[model samples]
Target: MQYKPASWLAAIPLAAMMGVCVGQAGPSQVGPDPTLPKPQRGLLPDMVIAKPAPWGDKTPTVPDGYTITAIATDLKIPRQTLILPNGDILVAEGKGGNAPNLKPKDVIAGIIKARGTSSVKGGDRLTLLRDTDGDGNYEVLTFAENLNAPYGLALVDNNLYVANQDAVVRFDYQPGQSKASGPPETVTPLPSDINHHWTKAMTASADGQYLYVGIGSNSNITERGMTAEVDRARVWRINARTGEHKSYATGLRNPTALTIQPGTDQLWAVVNERDEIGPNLVPDYLTSVQEGAFYGWPYSYWGKNVDERVRPQDPAKVATAIKPDYSLGSHVAALGVDFSNEAMGAQFADGAFVGEHGSWNRKDPVGYKVVFVPFRDGKPFGAPVDFVAGFRDKDGTTRGRPVGVTVDPKGALIVADDLSNTIWRVTPTQAAKSQQPVAAAQ
Candidate 1:
């Protein structure tokens, strides 16, 4: 079924229907707001899409001490990034989802959402980038081609694991190699049928003994039924050698990105909570993922805040729901998260950098850039600082939206801009003083 361009007209009445007042909840309501308003259901979720406007000669704005530059451009939907031991950057460039439209509204919503994404087809491969001359600019090369839509990347020992949409696959990795020559070996099958949230965020343990995969729920509040949510809305821990897997954490609607905190064994996740529950009800969060902990998905949110819309409720399940550690604001769509232990400069050296992919379900768009959430003693400390901005222009046109983020070997920040198909490099002016050559593949 083709999505009509005029389908957006169907969403125009959403603001009045929901009584949406933009900025009702300001930045004060961002982190762990003590007062969360009651959920307000709308017949159709509010649609505020930022139309794509490619970055002509402009770059993203950064904080005073930091500068932004484009390292590579003309990529096809780069989502996540992995910095190799030899300083080579591996970019997973693809997008894949086949969730069927459940209603007429779904069709209209799909059309509006599609308008925000890149028009170019996905590359469906891992592209390698290397700054051979110690310059900020990178020389791009195709590392591997003709694969599924890969999202997460993890390198353990000599094995590189790729979290494809449907499965986790393993490939042989060499220290400075630009290409992965052999076919991939499937490690474990991921739940992908009726994939409402298709991204499978994966991270490996520091010892390389275990793998963690984040699988999102099938639909908002299980509207698609519980049968579609089996083995989902949770993080799966897999044996790197045996492929044996079990649920590590549960009840997260969409844990978009996962990472292991440095100097500790604790695992953390950035979750995208459910929508259609007012513009400021459920807040997206970043929390430490505990083994077997339930963070509350369809039945509840933020501890025991029961979502009445999830019918045939389970009071027992809601009682077991654990509250998230910190909230990143409602509809922020916190996607990419990484610690700053190995990051450059003092300002960014103690926190997590999160890539906010922006929001479409709110009357006012939020989270169009990257932010830094400070950490003290391995826990979130203060308010989130806006590290990168300028994704959305004054007229609300999106020049680019950030997805996956990583810190290069020299500690410079690397951001994958999917809308503009560009990889941006952020470096402190001081760090740029000592340039180091990127080792070229033999």
Candidate 2:
């Protein structure tokens, strides 16, 4: 697929379809709503809420009693993020360490070199640590080297499991190790087919027993099927202790986020839908992952319903796959996801937050913000609500694109923005205070 820069307003059609009024520059879309309830105050605009040195893209407006702060900046190329037990954050920057020395021609050369298996470009891994109290700034804690598009990360016990482009490896992670402690352990030797290598997204169970990895399909929808030898649009569960692996479920085009529910241990995968189909055709989805179940990819989509355009190749198999539970907008490109437990504030007690990476294929751009999917008894209820927005400016220019999301130990939301190479910390007032211990009587 070829990529060309287009007006960011292309995403307006999607927003309008969702009942959001697109405002013109001179006048607000809804006009002065004296009669309509006032937009509750305390919600900071993009400029004010994001403080100190607000980067590109004008400031955004937020809801009541909440604020956004950029805890770090000048990151090379931030991707997936994980909050360590000790409060330090772990970030996965894709091919970023090589940024300082790489030129435009070098990047083009790297892409061309990436065409074959023998070509190995270096400098893909680095870890940033926010030492707030020490020096009041975030810095690189570790500068790891020689990784191939490393994306997914899971810290089990003292071991850090990483999903490289071709295999899953483990490194001994000391609580404060600046470098990998021991030799790399090759857990799973995946097929290193350079073509469809979606081997970069995964998450581990809270208990640290199993690791869920997403190996997205090579093609939009393979003509053979999603399960053939090379067609890998599925999630796999690995025994964290033994390295044994099994297919957790199947048929998701790119189930980027694989999160295990806090209390129930149930697994959920937020998948990005297939592209090229008309605007609202195939719904991108967030759903519970059942073991041994097929999720309808390739020959089928959105459940057992066959995608006529791609179904002729596997007419016999569509009868078995299951449909998705919740449908996000088509081609919105939902990626990072995490569930908010009761510890988080009242509003997010039992909700799931997703970071939509934004769309390039649609006539209009879609998904450059965070959305919340409410859950009752561990199941999604009603439609998803917009939790965080305003990644694009009023003039339709995108300044940041959210890729990974995780709730911090203090219950604040942590989002990784790839475009700005920064991480945003979203905290609700009273929520952090609730986490603090009662002061001594004085």
In order of listing, the candidates' clash counts read 0, 9
Clashing pairs in 2: 10-364, 10-365, 11-365, 45-60, 46-59, 46-60, 46-61, 47-59, 303-323
Each prediction's whole-model lDDT (CA): 0.85, 0.64
Worst 10-residue lDDT window for candidate 1 reads 433-442
TM-score (C-alpha) between model 2 and the true structure? 0.76
Question: How much is the lDDT of residue 34 in candidate 2?
Answer: 9
Which lDDT tens digits does candidate 2 get at residues 223-331?
Answer: 4344443537788888888878888888788778777788777888888766444444456778888888888777777666666566355655677788777776655
Deviation in Å, model 1, residue 373 alpha carbon: 0.1
User: 256-367, model 1: which lDDT tens digit per residue?
Assistant: 9999988778899999998887778689999999998999888999989999988899999999999898899888888899887444676677778899999877777789
Q: What overall lDDT, based on C-alpha atoms, would model 1 receive against the true structure?
A: 0.85
